[model samples]
Target: MASVSALAQVDATPRVSAAVTMEQARMVDIRSLVPDISQSIAYAGSNNFVGAPIRGYQAPRCWLKHEAAEALARVDAALRERHMRLRVFDCYRPVRAVAHFVRWANDRADQRSKATHYPDLDKSKLLGDYIAPVSGHSRGATVDLTVLRCDAHDVDCEPLDMGTGFDFFGIRAHTDSPEVNAAQRANRHLLRDAMEAQGFRNYAMEWWHYTLRLEPTPDTLYDIPVTAPTDSGRQAEIERLMQPYDGDVPGVSLLVLKDGKVVLSRSYGRSDLERGIEASPATGYRLASVTKQFTAAAILLLAQDGKLAIDDPVKRWLPSLPKVADGITLRNLLDHTSGMLDYEDLMAAPYEGQIRDAGVLALLEKEDRLYFPPGSSFRYSNSGYALLALVAERASGKSFPEYLRTRIFQPLGMRDTLAYVAGGPEVPHRAWGYSKACDGWTRTDQNAYSAVLGDGGIYSNIADMARWAAALDDDRLLGKASRALAFERQAQVSSTPEATWYGFGWRLADGLQWHSGESVGFRNTIVRWPKQRLTVVVLSNRNDPTPYDLAISIGRWFMADAQAEPH
Candidate 1:
């Protein structure tokens, strides 16, 4: 759990006070130390894993201890003599910024940066190797940088291709990975040589990362803000939006996107009732069946890559599946027309602990039957999405989460979303799920099959959902054709006056495309009025009273004249 002080100050930079020690005062801005050095602080922008400006990094300027900055200046001069210069990507990361990384790494569901940074590895594997609670950079002695060719006055230069981009979390980014060509290898050597000559040592796992051998303040971790200060009056809007959730129970984090811009973002109620932790915009809520669209998107992404056809039979990948499933195609699975038995219902009465995606297949194999012929009818089946997840993994040679992270989340910059799994990293600012009890609110965070992904088991917040909503409207991830397939009516699953048509993972009725999720102690709904360029995401941590109604009521605010018939 994050400290209240830390959480409260996340958006604010640390200011120097009279009590500051002389050693702390020695910290100097890198620009003042080396006026000519090029800097591009990734965390200060949306380029980092968090997909937003990191906590404490209010500005893009680099800061470092005086001694370390002087050493870096010397290295820059030496590189300039060789008609090259050092361009710093990151320097003097704050302790708060490192805490933000820890929170992100623990969130199994937030893989938006996995593709660009760690496509081949799971987010859980990044904790010890690529990310840690404590970093040398926080001590003001480490820097992430690349080499750039320069001309007179250091203008009109090109960055040397070092095989992999900075902050890439794979073997290719290693100092000696044997994956890069000779030219890229030489470039890495050149950067390392200059830094090492100035008493810096390269981290073996990252070519662009280096720490001074004799750090100026090895024992100190600064909490200074990275960006200059400013005041924004948006807090009033946030407070107003949170007015309804002014109670002791768990709350909701919401975001409204109109015309690709976030007009509202707010949080309410308690994140952890037992700890008396108030919910904030950072709190993550289990998305439940809201995860279905992501699973469907993964299948679509695989199809786009030509790794597998949507019409390919389920057995094409899962050879062990029973003959009954042979008629089921990947498209059938995406659209919930596979007729596969619900794995949740098949689980034993007492309920086994948590079943993973693999366990879902194993259970399905034991049953040698289908509810209906594949693609002939529509019935929402958690089993179909689970199988789709398997197909995606097999087709892409990556886990379901990894594929979504690399292909969808990262591409769209939805940094705070992920298909969560048990034993994975902790969800930062996590809103503990709760249910109404005779006595009071009771913790009901996980169900018997909470670990099973695909159909559900994702966790996210409204800030990230805004990005996701934007992607659905554009051809950023899926092409125009694929997007059409995702939203097109595939089966008339319901025929009543208040009926819904089923698409890949969305429920279509009139001009509205939406989905709702209900788990042990969470309820969520996301509604997109694409024609109006409006999206409303309501994520609640309480199980009672599903959020679909609230989402519909909110949607009316944006769709008064163009309100579509409701389901």
Candidate 2:
């Protein structure tokens, strides 16, 4: 079945004497430590010199030896302090992938990428110097990346002008090339300085290449597929910690995930006290303020589709708003720095009925002034998100709920998750909220703002939320660049008891990304430790005890071994 060219290609590939197992290599994904670092893996796709997807790259993930990954995380952390980040192009090359590169280098017939990659050099000259038979990446202590600078608000980010593009096989790609101008050379040195401070030595020929000073496995190559790691133990301890929810009254649903696998999923108590239905992982509970994250995501999706820009002024879309809202931008709304007056504060005493998102917009349209000027300070405003829902509807020309269903939930295979619009579509496996009374728990679910679809009105269960958490890990629904904007610290919440920062819709505290929701009778929270690829979600129907602190305690059990400090 093989042709002469194919047989020759196979013969040119070198044999691998030995390769280490994953456990022996002790490798970790850089994303597990630096969650917000940007990645654009060139070889994993058809964007590189070979002009084809390389073999042995199952996923576009960056894995390095434990020590080297830690060092790279340090470099990323130091750069973030100055509103900068690392955008990696390649890491931890597999032996087979290297073989693919070598085979392509020897084939003189395939000159498709010549103009872009190796314009000045002959293909025959690439084997010894650039395309080596054995690469340091196979040993798992090497990485290729460039620096990116964010705007003053840390919202928009773009890569710096390096002298030459990555993988360019020419003298201009050299780290100390004299052909580069002053600004480009300065940018190159800036990256080198940051990486060298963390014990990385740059290759003199390539500006984007660097390796750890001390390699963990200098001789052996690692061939384990790049995938998320899953631990076998730690299930019983988690169940014991969640024992309180295993009861008869209105209760909670909990899900714990490690490396994208379900570690513990259990629900206790009754979802419907009247019907005598037991709670399970499928019981849908109102997300309350947690819905803000979905609303923010919807806006970002619209931006990605070229419907709107995150930096556009609110008045550009909702022109009927009063002059006080003129300076507010969509970024301010997502960051909760818009300073829009809380619509709840503007509601009449003992409001007659539940105010929908449009009503919230109407109330803001009449307000004369804001609590503060836009982007001047931080104040969580439900009004901001409600207005964003209207913007999403107008931009996409579809109802907010419909956009989420077709674009996000359906694509992610989250069948039961939905935005709760009364009398539109009934919730499946629904759980009614309850509050404690002197005698027993009382039904106290919907309130004046329950109908609002943006600030706090989405329903999901443990299973669906787990899918959402996994989607955030990669660019399945959101691109890598958009994720960086949403995860970056756009606002400083407080510096008191402990430092806390606010990204788009998530809270950053003590190296944990989390958010809590509270309504009339629902209290829920989700905590994520990106460094360990761990997540803990607590969705409760009774409001007596808040689950924010509880979720953090559960997250700590897994992140106890993580060494990277919080950004």
The candidate 1 region of ten consecutive residues with least summed lDDT is 1-10
lDDT of 2 by residue, 25-92 (tens): 78887866874456666565565788776887665668888899999999999998998877777788
Q: For candidate 1, write residues 1-567 as lDDT tens digits.
A: 111111111223433233133244466766565644555565765656677778977666667778888999999989888878767788877778888888888899987878887889988888877777667777677788888775454433457888987778788988888999999999999999999999998887888888888875566567777753122333333333443453345778777788889977766566677754546556788988999999888888778888988899889999899989889888888888888999988888887588888999999999999999888889889888888888888888888888888888888887767777666656656778888887568999987878878889778878788888888888888888889999999988788877789888899998889999999999899998888888989889888778777777666665663455474
For residue 461, what is the lDDT in candidate 1? 77
Among all candidates shown, the one with the greatest TM-score: 2
Error of 2 at 433 (Å): 0.4
Q: Pick the candidate with the highest lDDT.
A: 2
Backbone clashes in model 1, listed as residue pairs: 58-227, 59-227, 106-425, 109-417, 109-418, 110-417
